[model samples]
Target: MESTTALDPATALEPATALESATALEPATALESATAPESTRTTESSTRATVHRPAGPVAPTDAAAVALRPLAGRAVRLDPDGFLGRWQRRNATETLPHCVTNLERDGALDNLRHAARGERQRFSGKWFADSDVYKTLEAAAWWLGHADDGRLTELLDEVADVLAAAQREDGYLNSWFQLMDPEHRWMNLAVGHELYCAGHLLQAAVAAIRGGVGPRLVEVATRLADLLVDRFGGDGRLGICGHPEIETALVEFFRCTGNRAYLELAAGMVELRGRGWLAEHSVDTGLGGSSFGAAYYLDHMPVREAGAATGHAVRQLYLEAGVVDVAVETGDRSLLAASERIWEDLFATKTYLTGAHGSRHRDESIGDRYELPPDRAYAETCAAIASFQWNWRLLLATGRARYADELERVLYNAIAASTAVDGRHFFYSNPLQLRVDHDGTEEDAARRQAWYKCACCPPNLARLLASLDAYLASSGPDGIQLHLYSAATIATWIGDSPVELRVDTEYPWRGRIAVAVASTAAAGSWELALRVPGWCDRTPTVTVNDEPMDAEASDGYLRLRRAWREGDTVVLDLPMPARLVTPHPHLDAVRGSVAITRGPLVYCLEQVDLPDGVRLDDLRVDPAAAPIPVAIAGLLDVPVGVVAHGFVEPDGEQALYDTRERPPHARRPIDVLTIPYFRWANREPGAMRVWLPTA
Candidate 1:
């Protein structure tokens, strides 16, 4: 069977002239600078604020203003034997190196060399290929923060040196435009991706600065950022990138350097969007003359007026991340509220059962509410990563548990399902269901490939996994709040006093979480909050030092306050029962089907697990019987699987359409085995479905 066809990045481009009158909207007055002095600025929200800038990707100058503050990169360490620990180590050992090797092999780095040597005809890879190198470099920087690797260091130095040599005197650094289209700089904003590439470079530099490495790369990025500020900051050409990301990157750069200009530039850029520039020039700028109009670039409405997510899945999510960053830093309540409203609408209607987004493959864009189709889902891996990134920022800004819950859903399902067990192969688009005859050659094939022509998700995964620990926990005025469960050591400051703790758990498989207090600098009282996942049906049991504690949770967290403790322990037991989940009636795609879940993991049935002569389409789960837990090993060392009772019905007539008056389909009792959604496709490629029809 041939694969269902769809438009990919390569086919989306064509040669066309830029519209001279695209910038018709008069440049509006710039927003007042939101950045303040080097000293921390206390806000109306919180009085007890920490002076130090909170670490991780987001560092709001006013730390206490936000609901939760992430601990510094050096504060938390995952145990090597734990689940996320293995992922981080794998990224360091396999994925990181793979990205570096591919950049060299696939001509991303060589493009820079070509530009440096003034060679114009030999440019290679996509126009946005430079972003991949930046993302990979960021992964290296973050990994180097905790682990030392000679090979990664050498590669980083080599790349940084190439980038420095290739960069023009004015801090412009794109290899493609430099070598191929020098005269059209910033001419084709809709499809050029020049600013988009620069944004990734800035983010890589920010990571390097935060991780304490790559000073030369930092210098190069700073120079480039300075150029952007000079060109677009104030009373300059008023235009926004067709793709966002520079807004967030500039804000982070401002946080790192305390240069008010970058922050002002980011704020101005955010303000300048929705003014109909990209929409006016999209077709003229050679975007394949497609029908993806204003909404495709999110130029349909202003960010503040937009209520729901639209446009390309990755683009929408990336823009939202920058919006939130600008909102938090500038203390714009209206902007923040707009972001929250859009997020609420996105989760309520647009999101999929696997926490994936983007239903339309033609444009790689988010579809209408409840329009999710399992078989045709274009839940691009980059979109999943973008969703996680957006959710992480929302979590930090509002300290909302729902944001954390969304993060867990995407991470355990969509994001985790992206990479193969070997860490080399990856799925560009994650589909919940793969028809038995799914075309293996399609760009969105169900099976993982070593690399894609676009090849964005691999390095994106690397950077996320390498920096995963920072998203697990946060510190507030009183104590630490653990968002994601993992075996790790957390050391953070609480009002000038240091506190250390060790967490032990086998999460997503079991419910037992033991938190042991290792040391406390302050003998006074402080609080520790644990997130009670929204998926927990029964009341989670909690105990302190083996004593039952009846603590009522508020805002999805159980708070326990205590003082003067060493060797004291806290244990939380959340019941883990496999349950069948049903989709909303409005979701016609899988309305009659059900999905199985245990703890934080979603389970799916692969054809390889079916009995002989049983086709995946013929199986119907027995909704009355509960799914049973079974242990498995040797495949990525995953420990658990689900066994569900179902019936395998014989295929009906061969006709595409059948009458209801046909004879009843015969059924035989069958046991269907399901692995974690993330673990599927790691084995033999076969048909798989997360939503099983119920008998």
Candidate 2:
């Protein structure tokens, strides 16, 4: 039986209707709504009058500036039985509760409590411990918007009250600073994370207001934001944080309230980057900091002048997300173009086959071009989440299928792989390969843990999963566009009429999509756009009500325009064939290897799947024999296992280096069984390799 907490749009818990009440909390402000000219202002009050609430976290005020507009959070929902829906269920039932428990266990909650009491004591956990609490708050706000859970709701109310108590009169509210170092507030811009923490608090506040939660949290965050504007706004301090989270968060806050100060502040911070703002500060060897100069903090060069993705992976991606947000809001074309160039460079030379980033484990930074190494991959889980966020913003900005493609790729492989099947454990860093000789002793080993000292990835995953349905599809003036396919119901307004659609599919496993138009208020002409995934090399077959209708796809979207819709179904068949993918020729680490893929799921060979004594390093797959799909029962019910023909190489253990000579030993033929990359490390901890050597 489905859990009682299953997210149903019919339930009264739906927050979309809660926006009208929440809008009362927004404070009135005289600041300009945006940095754009008077003719192009994208203020919330003037442009987005029809939207009941901001669409998810990346809502842009001006819908005309972008090609596609995201549906409001209460507008769409995922079916409880679908793949994403099941994961979201796990997130709510297991992952979110775990985070709440850990937050209390790890002293995060007490930190705020102690601050509220004005008691002086040593700070607990990392300096950024407050961020975890804020992220969980955001997740709870979103979940409460969609479903009603007594425990989570109570927790939200309690946290808001505590935050309100702890906040200083002037609006500053970092627990670490309040408890440990109040005298040095905002002194260490490079490593203090003051702005970063403030950004997350603002994000949580935005989620609360949009999710139809209480007003106290929003009031507290507003005070802090006002303080930030006073301290760092146009005529104030000229600095940028070592982290890049504040810019995007400020923009969202601006969208939630009609405060133009937030948008201009975010834009100014983005413009301040790459101008050596943090060069004078000594290198702080912290979790995300590095000794690799200003680039590690994204302060090496002007964001517009930077040609390729550089420095820490999460910082780089987060900065890009903020840049895109600023560009869309301010009508700055150059910033968007700059982000596009870096994105192209990233995929061309930096990204791994599993859509993961970060190649160096030393500083948790993306390595130089073509420096990818599978065994040494530092694909931090937070980086993958950051990448997904950046892609979503880019998708909204350009309405390009390629951005959606990357979003799907990372969600299925990297982001999904971060959590265990049970959802209680998580991986901080995701490497493509785990060598057989690996001891699995370090935190970055092939095993997932219940919690970590950093603990950033767990809560981050919680928030992403909590609000995932918002990314399923989007709407525009003409009609709607389906980006990620799954079993769901989407209802949104197109002009003066209401359009509702029901999508049925077991996507990434089976590709037959049946989009049934449940109802439409208007019988006039309107269009429905469906994305043709970039991974599908074969032509997709589309039909309207069982009648084949041929139409060329434009910009990766197949559009169908019709005058009337009632009980009309559109079926799209995308052939799912297992294929081998090779890396760029310049990637020397995996030069002679290929990864197995079907649909968007990347496949890998695990030690448990091999015969006794068969080593992953000694096997070579034959690309000529195509991979075949077979039924499996371990991970997901709908997914299938892949089988490929391969042979074992002769033993070469005699020497580290040998002369060029052919061995006489005969090779052993074998049938290699590969499972989805996200499913590995679930059964047992052992060798796992995504890119297998190909013959």
Model 1, position 53, has a per-residue lDDT of 38
Give stretches of model 1 more than 4 Å off: 1-54, 280-290
Please write out the lDDT profile of model 2 over residues 225-282, one tens digit for every residue: 8888888888357568988899999888887776788888999999889989886643
Which residue pairs overlap in candidate 1's backbone?
Answer: none
TM-score of candidate 1 on Cα atoms, chains taken together: 0.91
Query: Ten consecutive residues with minimal summed lDDT in candidate 2?
Result: 25-34
C-alpha TM-scores of all predictions: 0.91, 0.91
Model 2: per-residue Cα lDDT at residue 406: 93
lDDT of 1 by residue, 1-695 (tens): 01112212233212111112121111110000111123453221121222233357767775324788877655777776667877888888888888888888999989998987878868778888999999999999888877788888887788899888998998898998888778777777777888899999988887887766787888789789878876776845656888787888887877777677777788888887887877564334432434788788887888989998998999999999999888888888799899899899899999988899999999999999999999899999999999999998889889889999999999999999998888898999899999999885556886788888898889999989888988889887788899998877777767767677778787777777888877777778998999988888788899999999985678988889989488888988887778999999999999889999988999999998876677999999999998876666554566667788989887777467866666777778987778899988887879999999998
